[model samples]
Target: MPHCVILYTPNIEPKTDLGALCRKLADTMLTVRDEAGKQVFPTGGVRVLAYPAAHYAVADGKGDYAFVYLNVRMGAGRSAAVQKAAGDRLMEVAKEHFAPIFEQAPIGITLQIDESPGQVYDGKHSSLHPLFNK
Candidate 1:
């Protein structure tokens, strides 16, 4: 399972389309595959969500600043290279989505991929997994 969460400043909403960004991310996740060409992420296990930050500070609490933080969480056992590739793809989408805001004001875009340890990560997603034939 891969859950992509987008947290952005409220000011960016007027210029950025969070819904579109989320859909793009989900699509990108669906494309990730291992060396054998098998999909790395399950189709039914992908979730994309966006949240608007009402109160925040960018750098020393300046004016007209926007920030976009993408946190992607998934199950453990993927190679470093594969993780990097996924992140790079997601970042490309993010940059394209926020290009307008980048030109207009000071915008900070960041992305982080976190893989939960298999020992501590307990998951129960049978329903969706079967639907996707995963």
Candidate 2:
């Protein structure tokens, strides 16, 4: 499972279409392929969520600075190269998406990928996955 969570300053939300960003990110995740050309991330296991931080400060709290932090968590299986490539692509699209905002204000965009080899406890119950698998 790959769950992408995006956190950004609320100041950027006015000029950002976060819903579109989420869709774009999810779509990009679906396109990641391994060396064998198999999908790196299963279609049903991908999720993108975004949140805007209403109360926050940037830099010395003097300028209008905004930040976008994207944290991607997934089960471990892929190689380091594969993960880096995916992260690169995701960051590329994210930069492209916020280009407008960048020009209008001071902003920082970051993407991080976390691979979980094993969890102490894990659980899942969903019918949505069946739809994608089928």
Candidate 3:
């Protein structure tokens, strides 16, 4: 599963549509492809969400500041290149999502890819993928 979590400051919520951003991220993740053009990430495995941070500090705590921290957690097995590709795409979508807010305020963005070995990460999904396939 690639669970994309966006941790952002509350100050940006007025201009930022978190739900739409999540959907964009999930859609972007699906664009990552293999040599045969198959989606590298499973449709059912995509999950994107955002959380607001009540208290935060950014670069010396001056003025009204905002930040978006992205953490993409996946089950470990994919190659490093695949991970990097996914990360690059994630950041691209994130930056695009927040472009309007960035133009008007002090905002910071960061992204990281985290992995959990299959042994410890367990889950089952029976329906979601089929809907996407069709």
Candidate 4:
């Protein structure tokens, strides 16, 4: 599951489109391919969800500041290069999406990729995978 969870500041919601950003992120995830050029992440398990923090405090509560923390979680099995590529691509897309707002407002964006190390317990129950496999 390459689930992208976007935690952004509420202030930016008015200046940007979080829903469109999520869709773009999901699209970027699908473009991440392995060495053989096969998709690195399964299509059906991809998820991009954004949640604006109901309340948050920036580094200093001086001015109206905003931030977007994007974390991409996936099952481990790929090389570091692949992970880096995905993170780089995702960050690039996110940065481009928020460029306009960044020019007029003080906002920050952070992206991280967390690959499972085979220790975490993951339960599976999804009918969507079958559709994609076909």
Candidate 5:
């Protein structure tokens, strides 16, 4: 299971569309899955969530900042060891796709798999929680 999360602080602009960014990132994630032959989240499994940084007082008062969290759930068939292996693959894809976006503004971006115990898959399923919530 491969999942991705993308969060960013955009440069000062007339309008900041976090939704667009989320969609772009999601699309990038899909590409990564295709290229890597790795399942990020599950087939037909993708979710995009966005939150204004101001909601959490992140990056000053400018809500232009955003947090994007993605979760990919693979199922319980894969063992924890295999899940982690898959996660590593997905991480590589995330870094490649996200690096350019982060370089543009140098905003806080975090992408990783969710290894937390309470995650949707955890040990029961092969899931990746790559989050970029900055």
Candidate 6:
């Protein structure tokens, strides 16, 4: 599987429809294809989870928020060039999809490739998490 993880805390508006936003983001990520005409995303296996911040103290806090986590698994045999291309494409799509919401937030923003299990040139592995493992 592709050995990269992109994790970001999208600064959403307080009390926004996070479920809808998550669905949209997931859809955008799932459909990305590489230049070789190969499907770069997992086979109906991308996972998106929305969790409210643990620091949420006030029930009526105007800045209440959730975390959007996206996980993708790709074939381990794919070339490094293909993997990088795919990852770059996915991030680009994500930024475009979430641009409007992010622009309105107080904090600027950060998108990170939090976990990369393989070498930048070549490697192989799979990722299983609490949400998708089930």
Worst 10 residues of 4 by lDDT: 115-124
lDDT of 5 by residue, 78-111 (tens): 5566566655655555455455555554334345
Which candidate leads the pack in TM-score?
A: 4
Q: What TM-score should be assigned to candidate 3?
A: 0.85
Candidate 1 displacement at residue 119 in angstroms: 4.8
Q: How would you encode candidate 1's per-residue C-alpha lDDT over 18-133 as one tens digit per residue?
A: 89899999999999998778787789889999999878888877588788999999788888988898899999999998888777899999999999885664657467767888
Taking the tens digit of each residue's C-alpha lDDT, what string does model 3 give over 41-64?
Answer: 788879888899878888888788
Q: Which stretches of candidate 3 lie over 4 Å from their true place?
A: 118-121, 130-134
Ranking 1 against 3 by TM-score, winner: 1
Off by over 4 Å in 1: 118-121
Error of 5 at 7 (Å): 6.4
**In candidate 4, which residue pairs get closer than 3 Å at backbone N, Cα or C atoms, i.e. clash?**
none
lDDT of 2 by residue, 1-134 (tens): 78999999988878989999999999999999988998988888899999988789888999989999999997888899999999999999899999998889899998999998878877889887899886
Q: Please, what is the TM-score per model?
A: 0.91, 0.96, 0.85, 0.97, 0.41, 0.49
Candidate 5's C-alpha runs over 4 A off are 1-15, 34-38, 58-106, 116-134
Q: Give the candidate order by descending TM-score.
A: 4, 2, 1, 3, 6, 5
Question: With candidate 6 superimposed using the best TM-score fit, by how many Å does residue 1's alpha carbon deviate from the native?
Answer: 6.8
Q: Quote the positional error of residue 5 for candidate 2 in Å.
A: 0.1
Answer with 3 or 6, whichever has the higher lDDT: 3
Q: Model 1, residue 117: displacement in angstroms?
A: 1.1
Candidate with the larger lDDT of 2 and 6: 2
Which pairs of residues have clashing backbones in candidate 6?
1-74, 1-76, 2-74
